[model samples]
Each structure stands twice: as structure tokens, then as C-alpha cells.
Target: MKKLLAGTVAGLAMLAIPAQAQAQDAKGAIQVKLLGTAVLPDGKITEVKTDIVGLPAGTQTEANDNVVPTLAIEYFVSPNFSLETICCMTQHDVDAVSGLTGAELVSDAKLIPATVTAKYHFDLGGAKPYVGAGATYFLWVDVDPGEATLPLGVTKTDLSDEFGFVLQAGFDLPVNDSGLAFSVDAKRYFVGTTASWYAGDTLAIQTEHDLDPWVLSAGVAYRF
Candidate 1:
């Protein structure tokens, strides 16, 4: 009876070792991931007004989908808490649609969003799932109103830089005993900006645009 009890205790001790090791491994770890990201626009350009005859009031805008490379770095503050920053730049073609006539005015712009998130991780053996919330600073650049708007005396288009909110959810699955893992993440940004259209030196129209976008990403991560 003594030997049997000792064997059972040894088995339990072995099980406890791995769990303790996992907790120690998770603390203060740094992870970096390179992901392919899809930027999907879910909001619209609103409050557009024009002085041109036949051009309608309340023009709406839509952005085209874009795929780009993304880099994310995370630092574990604890076994269940982390902070991450994701960086990427995307180019989007914007279209101005008339609410009255269904006509479209096309333009293009580039956006660089710096997003920071605080995440809570759920440990699940070899897999870790996380949810996060944060904010983004959107840098809007290279605004060009395509040729379609040039004939209408449009000379320049300006997009305002703005701050936005972000929500994120993702999971990391370890591929081996090494620090390599597979990661899949999704984020939503709630953002809006003002667009000013100019004809030569004069402002033609000023409109508010909502650029809320959904970002989906998948790739490999390495923990160090």
C-alpha cells in the first residue's frame, strides 16, 4: 500500500510540473508576428454637398478592399495579460456616389493606422485565445481625386487625420515545443474623417466620411 501511494503521488507531481513550467514560460514573453491583412471598409462617406448644378446633395462614399502585410509585436505583462501593437499601411480607392442619381465620383487615398491594444488571454493548453480593446491613430495621406473628378474642376482632395477606437480577438496555437505558433486575428476600427474637395485654390465641398474598417489577419508568430 505504501509503494502504490508513492507511485500515485509521483504521477501527480509530474503533472504539476508541466503546468508550473507553462506558467513560468508565459510571463514576460515577447512575441512577434507577420501577418497578411485584409482591410474591409464597412462605413461610408457622408454629408457631401456640391455647388455644381445637377450634382446632388448628400453624396455618399465607399472604399475598395485592400490586402497588405502587417507586423504585430506583443509583450506579456503577465500570464493572462498582454499589450500589443499592430502596424500596417493600406491603399484604398474611394468612390463618391450621388444619393439622388446613383452617379459615382472615384478617388484614392492611403491610410496608415497605428493601433495599440491591451489583451486578456485565456490559456487552453497548447492554444491561447485573446480579446482586446484599444485605440488607433489614423494617418491619412496621398489623397488623389481620380480623373473622373478632374473635368468637374476638382483639383485637390484632402483627408483629415483622426483618432479611432479598435476591438480585437485572436488566437495563438503552438505548432511545436519550440516558440513557433500560428496566429489568426481580427480587428474592427471605428473611424471617421473629414474630406475637403478643392478646385484650384478654392474649397469646393467639405464632407464627413466614416472609414470604419474590419481587418482580418493570419500568419505565424514567434515567441522569445
Candidate 2:
């Protein structure tokens, strides 16, 4: 009877081990992400290139170095899925040059890129990785001083409204149940605005431009 009881207890212990492991895999967590990038201009479309009513041929256009940074918070819906909301801040300079005559202004903008993303997280023992896809509504805030110049007095461009799609990938390094996450993301923005010249007569024209951006990031996460 003693030997039979010992065998039964041993079998129960083996079963308990797998159950504990499975339980550990089901818990959810919160994560934070940071991003950095340099933005490059994609150039004017055919319609803008053919415009005869605006700035003349001697007119020059200059776009400054655009560096964007982002901070985001994510919640795990499951071991393999999560959702995130990100805040983005960007600053740049735009200039118009015509026959050594020019005007320049510096502009800074803040944006909240809210997204509900579906993530596929990979478990690779100590280092876990993930990829995500989603759509974002870009809420823009102009932080400019509103001073600009042009031969035609085309001082400013309205770039306040935009929407975009996002794709991302990253990895996590465990720090207990929580970890540090490093990520990279790319977004294709569909943006359009009215370029109004404030010279003698206020002339307004609707122009379509691309504001596509990309980012690289690193941040922290905690699991409970």
C-alpha cells in the first residue's frame, strides 16, 4: 500500500508542472515604446509641378531636416496580441527662394496617432519578438509662430489634417515578467491642404501632398 501511494503522488506532481507553465503564459501586461527618425521629402506631384498660377520659375523650395519622436503605451490582450496608442512630435523648416530673394519659417507640430493594432508576438525563449499592423488617425497641432515670406506673399501652408496607415516590428528582452522593447515602424500618410497666397488678393488653391513618415524606437514593458 505504501509503494502504490508513492507512485500515485509522483504522477500527480508531473501533471502539476505543465499546468503551472500554462498558467504563466496566459497573463497580460502593459508596455511603453519610444521612436526616432529622420524624414525625407518625396517631392511635388505632376499637378503641383505644372501649376502656372503660383510662384515663378526662379522660386526655390526648401524643406528642413525633419526628426520625429514618438511615445506609445500598449496593452496586451493575450500572449500573442496587443493594442497601442502613440504620441508623435515633429519639427521642420520650409523656405522659398527666388533669384536670391527668399523667406523662411520654422514650424513645430504635435500629433496624436491613435491606433488599435493587432500584434503577433513570437516566443523565442529569452528574447521575444513581434509585428503589428493598423490604421491611425493623426490629430495635428500647429506650434508655429505664423510668420513666412514669398514673392507672391504665399506665407503659409495648412498641413493640419492627415490620416495614415502603420506597420511595425520589434523584440523584447525579459526583465522578470516585464521587459524592454525595441521597435521600428513605417507609416504612409495621405495628407492634403490648401496653399493660400496672402498677397494683394487672397488666392487659395487646394494641393495634395505626401507626409509619409518612418520611425525607430526603444522602451519598457511590464507584465502582470
Clash count, one per candidate: 0, 1
Residue pairs in candidate 1 whose N, alpha carbon or C atoms collide under 3 angstroms: none
Candidate 2 — which pairs collide?
60-97
Best-fitting candidate, measured by lDDT?
1
Per-residue alpha-carbon lDDT of candidate 2 for residues 85-145, written as tens digits (9 for 90 to 100): 7776556555544432445532453445555566788888877778888876656566342
**C-alpha local distance difference test of each model:** 0.83, 0.56
TM-score of 2: 0.66
Per-model TM against the reference: 0.83, 0.66
lDDT of 1 by residue, 11-35 (tens): 9999999999888877539999999
